[model samples]
Target: MKEQLIEKFENDMKKRSYFLRLLLVIDQFFNVLFWNGSQDETISSHVGRRIKSGKANRFEKLLCKFLSKLESEHCKKSLGE
Candidate 1:
């Protein structure tokens, strides 16, 4: 029973981590798209700092690419493409 509980806890943690990452990607994407150019620069600088600080991970780049594609598709659809 104790082992089962530990397994379940680990699974939950993994799910939570994935969800948090998804939310972070969405938030960053929105900030990039909707913010003025100056604000976009701020966001870029913040991301640069994270990369410099060794806090950025490879998964984030992948997420960004995926989100960008989705955003493009959304825009195209909105334009009746």
Candidate 2:
């Protein structure tokens, strides 16, 4: 069963080009970090300090929430939805 599953995955992957796979991997990471609430973490520690001390935009906060939700949904799907 495990070998069959692996073979199926390999077969599916063979249909995709290397560039496409790279793009997908990049996009998935971007979605999780950019859309997810991790932007604050991405900003250098110093910049993050400034953003925290100073006021952050309302839209930025909204974006954090949006990204968090998307991340959650993606996780749910990956868990075998």
Candidate 3:
């Protein structure tokens, strides 16, 4: 029973480690492809349209704010400068 428990724990740990590595690779890929400060054209258009509509829903304003914030943070992190 003790051996079985140890084996199970080891297997679980290996699985967790594999998951972490996979996640890291995914993150790195995204960071390279869409690093911080990158503005998505669709977001720009939507935000512009909402602002110009003179009738933005609360959610639109919130989304703009969120995107602006994300852009700023990403801009600082991106090596583009």
Candidate 4:
């Protein structure tokens, strides 16, 4: 299962441009930190500091959309829906 997920993620990355791939990597880093119990606002502040405020919001929206798609796919596979 883990291997399949990694393969899928890698293939998805390959389809994206280098700039987008970098943003996704940064977003995933913060996501992992958030999962490890970091406060949401704290992570948001860090991202905002690292990226322009306007661009940060755009990246966040993109991240949310990507995450929603991945979650939907996972749920369908898990529940056989």
Candidate 5:
């Protein structure tokens, strides 16, 4: 399930406009610094850590938004909401 969510997030991000994609790359750079980590880290780990720490930056927030939206939609479909 986690892998599926991550895959969906990646696909959604790819569908974003070029400008937004550029901004996301910049955000990712800063987030890497804020995380005091390397750029090699996967976004999923970064977002998971930010969610735990309650210090999500723009990129992390965007990821959280995407995940929440997906989960809620999944729930609604399952429950016929």
Candidate 6:
């Protein structure tokens, strides 16, 4: 019974790790799509549409905030701030 519990815990951990990695990949994909150029308005409009249409998930909205923060930090670094 102890060994079975240990095995179950290990499986749960592995599942969580896999989910985290998937989220990271998704975030990276959106970051590239929305931040690869100077088309900020385009990206914003697209996201707004997604939100209005109920096509965006909570995770995607959170990812938008994360990507925006990353972009701000990058800009600050570039400007030597």
Summarize candidate 2's per-residue lDDT along 1-81 as a digit string, tens digits.
999999977986998888976765665556457555342233222223334566545654454446558675332233211
Q: Write the per-residue lDDT of candidate 5 for residues 1-81, one digit (tens) a residue.
A: 999999988897778987977765675676577766556443555666656677767776676667667675331232210
Give the number of the best model, judged by TM-score: 2
- In the range 1-81, model 6's lDDT, one tens digit per residue, is 999999987986787787775664564466457655232223444454455577877765665566568675332232210
lDDT of 4 by residue, 19-57 (tens): 976775675566567644233223333443434434455
Cα miss at 13, model 6 (Å)?
11
If scored against the real structure, what TM-score would every candidate get?
0.27, 0.39, 0.33, 0.31, 0.35, 0.28
lDDT of 1 by residue, 1-81 (tens): 999999987986787787775665665566467543232233434444444567756754454445457675332232210
Off by over 4 Å in 3: 1-41, 72-81
Q: In candidate 5, where is summed lDDT lowest over 10 consecutive residues?
A: 72-81
Candidate 4 collision pairs: none
Runs off by more than 4 Å, candidate 1: 1-16, 36-81
- Backbone clashes in model 1: 0
Give the alpha-carbon lDDT of every model: 0.51, 0.49, 0.53, 0.51, 0.61, 0.53
Q: In order, what is each prediction's RMSD in angstroms?
A: 14.9, 10.2, 15.0, 11.9, 10.4, 15.0
- Any idea what lDDT model 1 has? 0.51
Clashes of each: 0, 1, 3, 0, 0, 0
Instruction: Assess the local accuracy of residue 13 in candidate 2 as a C-alpha lDDT between 0 and 100.
Output: 92
Error in Å for residue 50 of model 6:
24
Comparison by TM-score, 3 against 6, better one: 3
As a TM-score, model 4 comes out at 0.31
- Provide the lDDT at 10 for model 2: 100
Error of 1 at 59 (Å): 32
Candidate 2 off by > 4 Å: 37-81
